[model samples]
Target: MIRKWAMRAVIAYFLFGTAMYVYLFFIADTAIPQMYKGTSADPATFLNARELMLSEEYSNIRNLLFFLNKPYQWLFYYLILLFGISAAFERWAKKTSKWFSLQTLIYLFWLSLASFIVTFPFAYTSYLFSKTYQISTQVFSSWMRDQLIDFWVGYATMAVVVLVIYMMMRKYKKRWWLAVWVLSIPFSIFMMFIQPVVIDPLYNDFYPLQNKQLETKILSLADEADIPAEHVYEVDMSTKTNALNAYVTGVGSNSRIVLWDTTLERLDDEEVLFIMAHEMGHYVEKHIYKGIAGYILLTFAGLWITAKLMDLWVNKRGKIWKVEGTANISSLPAFLLITSVLLFAASPLTNWVSRYQETRADQYALEMTEDPAAGVRTFQDLTRAGLSQVNPPYLVKIFRYGHPTMLERINMAEEFKQQVSEE
Candidate 1:
């Protein structure tokens, strides 16, 4: 019965995904709006023929991967449950230790290792594609090292979360999800606070911006915007990728305005200032705090729904897929599967919120800098450097994009210019 349901779900998921992919990629009208057709916002004016071709191919591949990844993960979890691997791992962990926490850790280790191995092919393929398109500059060894770091860090984080959730489940039983949700609020804030100071330094070297002149200029902009930024840090991104980016991260004293070295290397001072102004907008507008609030609210609802679904599933298929209930360490895969599905379903809404915030930041940058020309040039350079699509299909924007399309950004800059001219 479980196998039959799984097969049917898989078929339906793929069929729907394929239909959407065909409509969005091949049938959707992705042309630039008529208002911006002949203006500087037009992509053809900035991107060369080869760049246009590459951007299209790159965007298509990325969109295809986005569509396939979730279903592939769901299938993986389903197969593990069907084949009794999760239950077997639980049994093995029990044999290793009498301590419950130890058993949980052991089970998590096996699960994490298995997941890493299973997903490595996808990760490597993504790297290969990026390398092919000149998006990634890191050598194979460096990439593998980063992948290992990611896996171990992820495993550790998962261990902590699973331990907490199971502890709540064991103690509270019926109201465990509520207890976990309450605890997650502070835990999430703490993680965000420490991430910039601790976790980020592990991946790349971050230091004060090397060009003192540029740093002074960025700091001046931050001051003008009342951003409370003391320093502009630079990360060594050229060692890993050619992408240009800048952002404000952390909260309170840990707050940082970080610029990728590639951004400084590729863009002129004025363009870089526009980027800095944009990041400062995120900070000054309190987007991070708002984002955390939104996350906490969503997690509260998501956990409540997940708990209900887990209860229903365990009642019906507990003996078939596992040896015990939700509190069982073995049920981790089931918990993950439910959460993953919810997150995927929530992508469109989350992306829309993110895009809205990003658009606001762009407007703030324009208002603060009052340099629409620099904003336009900055966005154009970003598109060229990243080979990003200027006008992706509606579905792609809805599901995947967290920022406005390139054309939209350029058009906004042009409009800002016109507004300033009239004033």
Candidate 2:
């Protein structure tokens, strides 16, 4: 009976994945219109930029990525396939007390293996570009080694936390929904604090921002913007890649501005200042707090709905499954399935919020900086440096991009320039 159920589980995973791929392939173009339909400074130019990206000349590189897209997608599907297989096997083993602990280990091994395989390629591609362009110092091999180490550490840490949550849910089987809420909220906080202090350093070297003059300027800018900044630090971003970036992280006293070393190397003083202004804008506008608050609220709503949905699902599965909770962590396959579906549905909502915050930051940066031209130059250089598509389909831009496209940024800056001239 267990063997029969295991086969059914494996086949179901393949079918679900296939269905998802089919749905995306067929409806992706229809699902979202690309450019910001919402009122902005100018819709005509925005539409032009969107149209340009879809043009063959502008999108050649993006089109080429499609060559690898399928293979990458298949790799993901197969990783999930492996995960489902192991999960089914684990469930069978769970039937007997003697095999329970051993099966749990086996389940963890496969879970780690699947996650590693899925994340490795993304990490590799990002690493390769950074190193090749001198954006990062780490070679391909070294990056791979580091990734492998990081993978196990991360996988072990997350798995242990999840296992504890699962145990709680199981213990309170009658109140599994309540258990999920209680565990997920604290778990989210645990994750946030751990990511910066522990996980981040494993990937990149974090040190005090080395350029004293630059640091002072940044702090002053933040003060001017009425954003409190605790520390200004630099990450050894060049070690892994050369892509230039600056971001503000943490909140209140813990909040700091981290400038990528590569950003300093590539940008001139004014350009760096403009970049710093942009990051500080996020703080000044309270975008971080708003985002976190929004996430917490949404998460609670989503979690409640998910718990209820899973409760119905668990009940449907009936006496055949002796799991304690509506959402069993040991039934990792089902957990993955449900989460993937929820994330897929939530993708558009997530993208919209991110784009809104980004645009707000961009506007704030313009308001804070004395040099709009510097912002313009920085955005232009960043676009050229990254080989990013200047024009992209409105649908693609809307769905995939977090930041506004290069063309859009330039257009917006030009508008700002016009406003200054009129004044």
Would you give me the overall lDDT of model 2? 0.63
Report backbone clashes per prediction: 0, 12
Candidate 2 lDDT, 98-189, residue by residue in tens? 54345555566666676667656656665554454444567767777787878678667756655664566667755655666666666766
Off by over 4 Å in 2: 1-84, 87-106, 118-137, 309-329
TM-score of 1: 0.97
lDDT of 1 by residue, 148-244 (tens): 8898888888889999999998999899999999999999998889889988987899999889998888888888887777778999999899989
Candidate 2: 10-residue stretch with minimal lDDT: 37-46
Tell me the TM-score of each prediction against the true structure. 0.97, 0.75
Poorly placed runs, candidate 1 (over 4 Å)? 1-6, 9-17
lDDT of each: 0.88, 0.63
